[model samples]
Target chain A: MKAPDFSYFEAQNIEDAIKYKSEDDEAVILAGGQSLLPALNMRLSSPSCLIDISKINNLNEIKIEGDFINIGALATHSDVMNNDLVHEKLPCLVDILKMVAHAAIRNKGTHGGSIAYGDPAAELPAFAVAMNAEIVLSGLSGQRIVNAKDFYLGLFETDLKSDEILIAIRYPLLDVNQHLIFDEVCRRHGDYAMAGLMAKVELDQSKINNLDLVYFATGDKPNVGQNTAKLVIDDGYDYEKLKKSLASEIDFAGDLNSSSEMKLHLATILINKILNKLER
Target chain B: MSAKNSVNISFSVNGENFDDVTVPTRQHLADYLRSQGLTGTHLGCEQGACGACTIEMDGVAVRSCLVLASQANGSSITTVEGFDDEVMQKVKNNFLKHNAFQCGFCSPGMLMTTKEIISSKKKLSRDEIRSEISGNYCRCTGYQSIVDAIEETINEIN
Candidate 1:
């Protein structure tokens, strides 16, 4: 299906994008256009105008500042995956990004667009949650930061306002002691996961000190397995106990491809899989 | 087309320049390419799922169906028809030798993706080659021929 007719505006800068967004209530920000264009082509979303922010200068920079790795909103998936800084600072992200869509889509899909799209089945949103990344939103008033966990409201819903644009995301530099492990069950390599896990762990003498278990495609948004994480941290990797606890803690939502039972089963398998990897 | 619906875009397609051409804002790059008689860029699923409409924009492969014609303004596009390089020629020869495609519906996208994989210059294993071209779905030939073709192409180039 073809996209509905709309007006297009190429923003020269962040200010221009914000101004354009503020002027039209039905305006959408066009970043890499990987996700937005598909939605537009399918008519799932039909904005009156698109503020093309792809050409905005410096919005695609991936750099380290202070204690955080700041990924500019325009940074494409390929950009993040292939960056030297990202490879050095957040190597796990490179592995996780390889599983995103495909090479062609990755070349055009922006990190901010993926997060802003807030697909429950996507890897990046859950990654942001596990890493406790800070989302930067710019609007007419000023710029404000939101935690990745709070930024996502529900499936395909985000805290992004109509008049605001996601400018960047800041992920705190991973400590030398910390390790990030990610795994997902996709029928095919590039398809959205049936269920996925992004676990950030800091182990002290092989005991789980800090663990952040974030699951995708199991709930409306990236569901943090807080209770499950607590249980694992408290009791170690006891498969039976953790499985029981996970069943009670995480609420699985069934989609067209997988059932709630299947998601729960897959989530449990992923949890055990990561825990075993940590032990090794 | 009304002024509100149409956008003036200038882009280079297959080394040819199109200046100030008016296209509907909703028209996708694949459709626009086909309209220009570069029908090699096929469209299977308009959504991003099927990579049938994959093409090179600004030197990187992207799904043309997922990119609006307006969004492609000022960019350089290369379809399967655009390849005249030695590597692409070798790749084509390998596909022909291996019978990489059956109906050839997915051939354009497969070729574009194959070109990218070979150009990456990575020492990829058979599994990696399979993973890299996973987006382009070929309903015919069961993909073994495609994989074999890509493997031989890489070996020939190296």
Candidate 2:
């Protein structure tokens, strides 16, 4: 059953969407409706009006404008999967996205919606943070860009104002010599992750030049599990250290499927596993 | 949230525009489309779990049960019935040959899903087909034939 209604305005565009925002502080912007509908049905949110922003054309843009690839917040997971530009630019995103919900859910769930909802178990923000992506948000106040690393303030929290909507996400294209890997564990495919890793490492002369490993479903927040990255980035970085570090990484979340101790065990094992595999 | 102040909602379903009567604000797209007598889009496990009420809105497939009719206003929606064209014919033949469905409760969802995959024109591998349709559940068929059916449809279409 649908939730009780208030008012509805099919916003003509970004400007129109913003207009509806002014009338109702309680107005919720409806994009793909994948997250919003579920949130409303769960009674997690009660907005007086729904500002349907699906009509805002430019908000869905996904293209290469130069050094950075701009992924519009409205871009669906399928849009990420299907686009040659996305595939060409960020295959790690593609890998992570493949594990995000199902074809049906991914077909309509928007990039912006996921980031805004800021579910700690979500894949995009972690990927965004790992990629050093920049978030762009707009409201009646106008637009602003936020780095993904800084955007996530806490679990299910971001530096987003109620009136502002995420406009786009921009990330640098991977340099040719760079390598990227995305891996996550879930009891079932398309469900939220039990644990996820988005890693990008730049290697030179069999030593680490830049080692960035981000862990999600392993923290209260969706941002990088900094300790895991710190373990590998220090001097004398190696598979041996990474393995030991993974074991020691704090708060490896435990629940129904796996225990906190087990996640730590897996992280330790995988850090060595991934780093070793990166060698050959 | 009352009758005195009503909201008009409209969108396309199965290739036809439906400027339907005012429904309560909370009415889900799945229920609204179903009540309007488009039964091809079935309802099962009203939550996102079972892909029973799947529809393509704005060229993307999603669970109708999870969407508000108001949110879908002005968007082009294609339900299972809308797939009664060539793509589905290919899908149905492939399913029949492969014995893709037994209970058939999942058939409508399967058809809607396979139609999207087949229409994509991409060379989808067995794993890709399996992953793409992972959301739809079929207790009886056990998925081998379904996988074969989709793979067959993909090969034939592409």
DockQ of each: 0.61, 0.47
| Best of the candidates, lDDT | 1
Per-residue lDDT of model 1, residues A1-280, tens digit only: 8888888887888888887787788888888888888788888998998888888889899999999999998899999998999999989999999999999999999999898889888999999999999999998899999999899898788998877999899999988879999989988888889999999999787778999999999998999888889887887667677777777877789998899988988888898789877778
> Which consecutive 10 residues in model 1 chain A have the weakest lDDT in total?
A235-244
TM-score to true structure, per model: 0.96, 0.87
lDDT of 1 by residue, B29-131 (tens): 8999999899999999898887899999999999999888888889999999998788888888888999887899999999999989988887789999989
Give per-residue CA lDDT, model 2, range A15-66, as digits (tens): 6776667656777777777777777776777888887777777788899978
Name the weakest run of 10 consecutive residues (lDDT summed) in model 2 chain A.
A235-244
TM-score of 2: 0.87
Candidate 2 per-residue lDDT over residues B64-98, each given as its tens digit: 88887767767898988778777788888888998
Looking only at chain A, give the TM-score of model 2 against the true structure.
Answer: 0.87
lDDT (0 to 1) per candidate: 0.89, 0.77
Clashes of 2: 0
RMSD of 1: 1.9
Report how far residue A181 has shifted in candidate 1, in Å. 1.2
